[model samples]
Target chain A: MIEARGLTKRYGDLVAVNDVSFEVGSGEVVGFLGPNGAGKTTTMRILTGFVPATDGTAKIAGHDIFEDPLAARRAIGYLPETPPLYPEMDVAHYLTYVARLKDVPRGRRKGAVDRAMERCGLADVRRRVIGSLSKGYRQRVGLAQAIVHDPAVLILDEPTVGLDPIQIREIRGLIAGLADSQEGGTGHTVILSTHILAEVEAICRRVMLINAGRKVLDGPLAELTRDGQRLEDVFTRVTLSDQAEASAGGTAEAAEAAQ
Target chain B: MRHVGAIAGRELRSMFVSPVAYAILTLFAIVAGFFFLASVLGFDAQVAEAQQFRAFDYLRQLNLNDHVIAPFYGIMWIVLLFLVPGITMGLFASEKTNGTQELLMTSPITIWELVIGKFLAASLFVLLLVGMVGIFTGILFFFGDPELPKAASGLLGLTLVALSYVAVGSFASSVTRNQLIAFFLSLVLLLILWMLSIVADLGAGGGAIASDGLVSRSMRWLSSADRFEQMVRGLVDTKDLAYFGFMIGTFLILTKASIESVRWR
Candidate 1:
């Protein structure tokens, strides 16, 4: 449902994301694993149409994100690194506003907001102001807004970050429930970006590991630990290998440019 | 455009809920009321002086449009220059600061649509402010006779001026995440535009070439104050109308570009 081809993003001389590519199938729960500044968020942002890739193409639900952004955006439910919320708006109103922005038909706008609220367990505090809500509730509101439009693909960046254990569990269950419910229907495609190995184990079946803006490994979770090596062991090995390789590569390029 | 409406509604709702909107409204009302009352009293004193001199011709000079409404509109224009930056300082800056810009940018709504929606929402709030101040004008209807069409035209001119202020302010806000920076940037730009015509006339460059010197003429054409003065005279010239339309459209396009450029960065 989501595909990226040779995606790269640069800020002036700083290459934020190097040539990278990945895909997520419909109804599949994929974990995007990367270290800090590993271009995980940039990749997700490209897929969600938040930022244009410096080079390469990203398509969401078969629509080119750059060429046909509106259609592509319509298929994506994105929870950015920070939840985009107006502090003064209450939870219910915020959802409704997002519903409207997502082009939820006027007749179905109310229903969509209500359903999203219920699914995210935000119904009890629907009337409460978002600014005053706890971090957990705010995260849930962010999740609720993303799914409010009923997009086919969900791109969440650190959805469970900063939450307490219970809140984290609830959010995880909510994500798992989304996939399970997909089994009986057309299903949803989820690409969750996180550094937590446990989060990947909890809900994600497939893991796409990235290092230094490069896709170092992508496979089913089962295959990654086939030789009795733990996921953490695999993560450290793949990421550190790139860290070493990147530094070596950087020096060579610098020497070549100097010469 | 339902997309535009949805964005506008949400923006206006957010603004009204914030204390900033109330602060601007209350402060504007107090300043405007003081000026309006002063204008009215000045007109009254002039009328008394004319009557004591038994000069019927002097009464003509006390026309409400000129003596009272015109100056009141001028005061409101200056008030807008100060007050309007508050309305737009947070338009795009807050979104960027609070990280909501990502959500907004990722949404299906186009950049132009978002800019237009924000500009319109701020314009609507300014309209509401003018409508509140129009209450003082209502006093004219009750106790005295003010030319209705002229008064209405002055209000239209004020709205246009406010729209221009909002247009500039919106563009300024799009360039930064700090509201104070946005406010000052807009204030400086508006001040420059406001003073251009006067500055031109005061210099040798103004009249050195001809009465229609390029520097002075161009400055006058760009000066919102100059156009608004013509509008208060109840002369709706197409050139004046086009000046405002072009000013607003230009700034809105720049604002859209400023926002689209963020994705690149």
Candidate 2:
């Protein structure tokens, strides 16, 4: 489980994450929906212990991310906005390296690599150099690396960005299969951030929407989309309400000044 | 330690597989080869011409202890100055350019592990390049009476210089995404240090007051060139070792700090 309270990240005078708080329990698939530069990536970074929060705390698997980063990180597998890859290495070599870095036991390294490659549909391209592979293949390689260690919490930032429709569908299927696999029974807890609302509606059980670094809404996807409301409509309504409130405050301040 | 080794191994493999590594190796070898050949040929010609004179023979007798290995130490310094930067220029710059830094920063590994891993990998590549030069220097054993201890000391000096260069190069790479900029930054910083020693030599020759000489002395103390010179003379001073160690530690810390700062922004 991952829990954050009053999480805030500030850059100089600008606030990237503003008093945002959320939680993801075990066996849950939560979608993080936010537009570009809406603090989605920053929040994810904080959760993964990649960056420290200016104020508040984040705990992963009952360990405070700041106080016990190694433990928290060991329990989480993160794929950032861009897939980290060494272009010079073949897919197999790269995956093996990541497995070792992720602390996969020596005896289980090959099995872990093979399982990751198969699950991510990268078995055929294992011997191919990552630089020679197309973007979709690279993305698959990234996915394979992320789950190679079999971390309980998987945080993926914009995993489906810049992929063809077929590739997207295949990746979505892979994530779904991973979440519903019978081996562990209770699927891995996943927190996927994306601007693609449709994919979230299609695959996510719960969704958290943030606009301008603040959480605007959070609930089960089915319940949030009830009353014949599309996910897009709900997103627009919530964001537009925030903008309206801000403008109304501005006008009220002007009126007070006039008085 | 395992995490650091894993990262270093991966980085070393990447260097071999990439075209840039081969390009750097080839360029350094070709340039250094020409420089070595010219210097050796020129010295041999001068020695042969001087051998014909009786006075020269007496001078040669007096200077029988003159070591031909000393000149090679100079050549090694030149080669290292030119080559080590290229090996390290892309260490962090390429990651930034390719946007892979984000991936690394988000990984479970600590900042120190990442920085030290990259530093060691780049240093190893520099050592490999120096090893090739060592093989070339080995040929001197067949041609003349070469001082083995001095030669080994020179190689040690080269390694220290290479380590210092890699640290600066890695720091430069961390500061920018552009490989060219990283290269230039490292080059400029090293050049300044090299020139400072020369300026200090001038100051010691009566250009500056003894009281104000501390700046020049400190600048000379920081220079890789001066340390290399001392090592080549068979003196492994603790101060020189400490200077290089401090340099390597400082840059690695800078790299770690830079990487950590990325998450905040």
Candidate 3:
């Protein structure tokens, strides 16, 4: 479970994320859609406790992210846009280090790493150095690290960005299985951020569209689209209209402030 | 703490695997060996001259601490000043450059744990270098009558100085993602701190007592080499110990603050 209220991040005068708020129930697979600079990554970073929000409160499974960062961080398994890997380290060694970082008990570290590797389909290349792996394998390693600790919430930023179509399908299926099979098992709340709309259709249960650091649409995937209007059409209409309005409003505010 | 150990263990492994570790070790050994041999030959030359005047008493009068080991330790410290930056430049800078800092920042580990872990790992590399150079010192036991207490104190002093270097170098790395910039920043900071005593001495030109004023005294007290000199003299003054401890703690805190600033930024 995750909750964010009035989240705002300002880098000097530029507002990277402004008054953004969202929520997801336990075990929900939510897709976060946004244009380049739509504050998706910023919001995720704040939630993961990697960056501080200028104003707002975020609670991760009941622990406040800002006030109780260690506990909140302990509940989050975050995979940033980059895989965050050491090139010289082998896959298993890297995962074991992550297990230690996530505070997996000594007795269960190997089991946790093994299960993560198994779930991510990375057992065959366990001994191979991460640098020697292909991009697809590297991405799988990123996914394995995120699930190594079995955290309550998983925030994956563009999990399928560089993978091929087959790899993408496999990752989507893996995510789908994680959401469905874990209904009675370990309930993992996943927030996936991606630019690809079709990927969301394939795996996400709910979609939230954001533009210019503001959430433009939030609802069930089916509810957001009309009887005949395609999702792409809706995405363009909402995002493009917001972009025009933002440019016009921004110029007016700047002129007024200068005067 | 266990968290510190886990982080430290990974850091040490990564360091050992890098080419930089081997390069630093080999370079330090070669340079240290050069200095050691030169000191021994220079001492041997002196002993030969003294034996002509007093053949029986000359060997007994040879002061191994002053003639050979002290100067060898001095050269070792200088070697460390250059090699230490290499060891520490990538500690935090490479992590940030490669984007692994995000994983570290989001983990349950605190900034202090990360800073201390990396610092301790760098210190361990310094220890390994000392251990390798210790083989050269061990040779003194067979041919010369070196004072064991003095030799032990000198190694302790060298370790303390290496730790101070690591602390500052870690802070330098934390402030920037560019390894070259980190290396130069640490080098410049160290040179300035070491040179302060020299500058103070120059200020008291022709004066017998260099500690003539508060500014000079403070500069001498702040000089890392000055404290090391005392330790080399087998005088482990509380003030000198406190100075090394304070230097290490101050730089570590500064490093933590820089990392925290990145999150806030």
Please tell me how candidate 3 rates in CAPRI terms. high
Query: Tens-digit lDDT track for model 2 on B138-173?
Result: 877777666677678777877888888898889888
What TM-score would each prediction reach against the true structure? 0.96, 0.94, 0.96
DockQ of 2: 0.65
Q: Candidate 3: list runs displaced more than 4 Å.
A: A248-259, B53-61, B206-211
Candidate 2 residue B11 Cα shift, in angstroms, is 1.1
Model 2 chain A, poorest ten-residue lDDT window? A177-186
True contacts kept of each: 0.91, 0.67, 0.93
Candidate 2 or 3, higher TM-score? Answer: 3
DockQ winner, 1 or 3? 3
Which candidate has the highest DockQ of all?
Answer: 3
Candidate 1 lDDT over B166-220, as tens digits, reads 9999999999999999999999999999998778777645445454778777887
lDDT string for model 1 (A46-112, tens) is 8888878899998899999989999999999999878998899999999998998888999999999
lDDT of 3 by residue, B1-265 (tens): 5689988899999987888788888888889889989989989988888887776676776788878888888888988888899899999999998889999999999988898899999999999888866778889989977888888788889988989999999999999999999999999999999998988888788575456788888888789887787777777888888999999999999999999998888
lDDT of each residue in A134-242, candidate 2, tens digit only: 9999999989988999988899898999999999998898887777755746778999999899999878999998887888889999999889899999988888898
Candidate 3: give the clashing pairs: none
Least accurate 10 contiguous residues by lDDT in model 1 chain A: A179-188
Worst 10 residues of 3 chain A by lDDT: A178-187
